[model samples]
Target: MSKRIAGPEIERLIQLLAKVPGLGPRSARRAALQLIKKKEQLLSPLAAAMAEAVDAVRICSNCGNVDTCDPCTVCTDPRRDGATIIVVEDVADLWALERAGAMNARYHVLGGTLSPLDGIGPDELNIKALIDRVAGGGVSELILAVNATVEGQTTAHYITDQLSGLEVRVTRLAHGVPVGGELDYLDEGTLSAALKSRTAF
Candidate 1:
């Protein structure tokens, strides 16, 4: 067994930081040290910000986006194309799509994909809300921007099946080689998708 290195407060900070994604115990210790070193400049402000977020942040009732309001900024924005809704597996995916600045459209976060092995199903996701939104009319298209995993595809297909009789046109993101990726570096499936989805140069 290792000896205790820090006080309870510092040890707790490191423990909580370690719970965050991509941050291990060693990195958390370094982070805790940095925060201690910059207490007034970083630690105090971060604490205050977290406190504020604790009271202010909420899940959007309409689309599952996390924000300070019930409907979120994306759901309330009049400038976005409400006729098209891009469905994503998580808020992180929604943020990634927004960072790309490619589509000025609304979004629906499904919370997660269908994974029976993990006991995650359509009812566990925000799939019912999505169906309600589509059935309410005005939505003309649904762009499935989910991951390429089996669970993601299964979830997408389930959603499509649910909206079978709806007038909305359901589509999916194209699979192919990335913009700067080399052909030799890509796998057979990616190469085949690129060939099948070839566009005019």
Candidate 2:
């Protein structure tokens, strides 16, 4: 067997890093070594940033978006359109939408989708908070930007049913083939959605 090379502290760091989403033990070890090699430039700054995030990270009470502030920058930003809100499945999705810069609307992070098998329900998500926000009025459109997965669609349907009595118009993010995607490579769902949502040139 290959003998353990790292000290206890370094080994611990690798183990912790391996637990990160896309990192594995080998990658973590490489990362740890790199961090140690560039301690002053990378390690110190990363550590400080992590510490600051740990101390300040919070969920926005109004929209469930994660940020350092209670209301979050998106919720409080005057530039965003208060009349339009995009409902997303996760904070990551919210960030993705923001990076796209397609619209200047606010967002509501659902936290997660409804999954009975996984013991996740409407109560577990930020659905109630979203309903309350919509109930407050002035929202002209509620865009459901959840994923096209089974759980995501189920959650979308449930939310649509819930808002049946509300006067606001609910919309969904259009799912179709990628800009340069070939029809042969697309799934049945994608093909169906693309055909249904086809627009005139």
Best by lDDT: 1
C-alpha RMSD for every candidate:
1.1, 1.2
lDDT against the true structure, per candidate, is 0.95, 0.93
Clashing pairs in 2: none
Clashing pairs for model 1 are none
lDDT of 1 by residue, 1-201 (tens): 098977899889999999989999899889989999999999999999999999999999999999999999999999999999999999999999999999999999999999999999889999999999999999999999999989999999999999999999999999999998899899998899999999999
lDDT, model 1: 0.95
Model 2, position 144, has a per-residue lDDT of: 97
Compared with the true structure, model 2 gives a TM-score of 0.96
